[model samples]
Target: MSIIIIGAGEVGYNVARKLSQERKDIIVIDKDEEKVERVAETLDVQAIHGSGSSISVLKEAGIERAEILIAATNSDEVNMVSCLVAGVQAIVPVKIARIRDPEYASNEKILGKEKLDIDLVINTDQEMVNSLLRILDIPGARDVVDFAEGRIRIASFMVEPGNPVAGKSLAELRKDYSNLELVVVAIYRDHRVIIPRGKDRLKERDLVYVLGESAAISQFLASFRDRKGVAPPTKVMIFGGGNVSLLLAKALEERGVATKVIEPDIERCQYLAQQLDKAIVLKGDFTSHDLLEEEHVREMDAFIALTEDEDRNILLALLAKTMGARRVIASINRVSFAPLAYQTGVDVVVSPPLLAVNRILQYIRKGKILNVAILPEEQAEVIETVAMETSDIIERPLKDLKLPSGILIGAILREGQVIIPRGESVILPGDKVTLVASSAAIPQLEKFLMVKLEYW
Candidate 1:
């Protein structure tokens, strides 16, 4: 299938790069010639310089035969128009748009197929805020991905120095704790990805991806934590009164977590104070040492830096950690800065573009797959796809199936039941299978599990 992405911004660029790696027929459209050149030069995909919302541009970009049309331009109107034309006029099977405006998010009828026929609308701010809270809710977890409607969760935890599971083989842990069935799907050590074997040892500081029941995963994560003596986050400080911070504070307040926000803009601070009932809104520069000290940043259980500026965010996040904040997270918009941000003192780094990309990709691969969560390093991917009747793996036990080398079935959802997969588990036609594997195995798994995944 052919895919046309409108916008060479972070979100579109990433989606193009990923789909290109899968060797799909991909074309990117951008009004800016520089962006088109950059995408054409860096990524192995065709790039066209034109306005995506224009019918002439779509025709020129081969939207007539394209299967998926992603409109991720900065302007909401452009994206909406592009999708409306693609779905209604051009008949593109999948239409995804990264919508940033909060005002446009409401009014379902307008976004519905009856009006715009937009298949999926991704609110970047909302997705980013939700991801931030998901990571923050679970302490010591670098990444937390929920599936099966929150029944199952796949969490990535850093094996710290004093972790009980550190230096232990998977076989030993499973043998010792028979009831603990949380499956270790993949391990990342020193920037290398390992589809772990039973005999493989978990080294200190290794990032372990475990999947199972939410409660089981949570309890299992406890074994990998050296933070038993440390207090859980109660009072949280957020720098930036942007939409994400506002939404996060509202969520935290509803959960009864004491939250405080610091924004330099006086008008934004006033708006935040007006909207938030209980959360404290402080007007000051969060990057200032004096401001942090006067606000007692050391007493904060968690510090989240979500300013628009990445450099400032990195600085404030480091300052928050140095000032004794128990947990620190920073928002890095650029994909290039993700590794550097993680290497810094920040505990967790979230990218809004990446979060939006996941939702968009899920929609593109929908029905064939329910949803997908991608690792930043592109080392591993956890996907939820239903076992189709045409799938060869169906009607057979998992162990008996000839699966790929790096892929492991994490869970199966059948008849509203969540099953932690095992050797004896069988995959039925209608069952929803959650698989975790190296990025290299995703194409092969998707090809077999999804019906008629025709590629150009």
Candidate 2:
């Protein structure tokens, strides 16, 4: 596919890098020659220097033959205009733009994606809030990747000493729960990945990668704790009153979760206070240890550092964890510190650029399978696909089914429980499944599972 991305920022660069790896003809355009050159040098793709919305620039970037046009510059106006110009022709299968403003988000008419000539509208801040909430929904989980029509999920969680799976073996767990179809793919023992062999045993403090329905992930976690009804809805403490924090606080409040926010700037704090009634807004510097203690950081269920400074965010999150917070999430826009944060026990680390790229890919390809991810320094990917409707496996019991190698169902939310399909499991209608597979295998995987049925 000929994919042209306008803008050489983090989102654009990430999209270009991913598409290029699939051996697609990729081209990137930007006004900054230095930024354009930098991306062009790092990724195996073409680049042009100019205003992305300009007709001359679009033409030079080969929009005529491009199958996908993505406008992801920092400015919403530029993205809208660029996509509009691309939409003039129906040849492009996907035309996506990044919409950053929350105010514009409320007015769908002014930026009603359909009216804007953009096939997909990506809102990074909102996506981050949604993603964070998903993590919070399932307490004690380190990472949650949904796949397989939303029925299946791969959740990574550390086994606590008092947890149910603390001393259980994979075979033993299965024997006990015969009705469940869960698989153990990889185990992180002492910061290492152990591709499971039947004889391996699960030990306490091990970070396990489990494959099951969304409910299974929760069920498995609950099994560990004493039948205490749902880890008391997390008492969330957020540091910073930026746009992202405001959205997060609103989202949390809607869910009836308690949220306390600390911001050093009086104006931002006042602005947040006026806009949000659900969360407790306080005018104080979160940097002060005295203030954090006074606010009961030690008693917080979760602490999120959303300040603009990456260094400060990491430091505060670490401190929160040290202070006995059960979970700590840091919003790190810089990609480089992701590994450091993870290693230091940061429960969840989110990056705006990474989130932006994933949102844009989802906007561009909604009906297709797209698993977006990044492995530290390496450029991440968005696997695009369409599930085949012709396969006999559709709606069939998973135990009686077989999936291609290198492909794992991340989630399958069918009616209710995100069934992490095990053997003997069945597929159902209207299930949103997320699959993780190599970029090369995505097309073949889609073809294999494509199901076709006869209808009256």
RMSD in Å for candidate 2, one decimal? 4.3
lDDT of 1 by residue, 278-390 (tens): 99999988546888898888988789998999889988999989988888888887877977987876788888878877787686553466778887577777888767676
Model 2 spans with C-alpha error above 4 angstroms: 106-114, 145-153, 159-169, 179-206, 226-234, 360-367, 370-389, 392-403, 409-434, 438-440, 446-456
Question: Which stretches of candidate 1 lie above 4 Å from their native place?
Answer: 224-232, 389-392, 451-456
lDDT of 2 by residue, 1-456 (tens): 688898898778877876677577988999998989998789999999999888888888888898888888889889888877776743677777788886755556765545664566788888778777777877777666555445566667777677766677877877776665566766767544554544678898787777676676687766666553357455899998988899999988887888999999998888999999889998877467888888888888789999988888988999888887777999886566777888887888888777676656554333454555432243222242433454365668765666665565544556565455556656555455555454445455545544322111
Top lDDT hit: 1
Note each model's CA RMSD in angstroms.
2.4, 4.3
Model 2 vs. true fold: TM? 0.82
lDDT of each: 0.82, 0.71
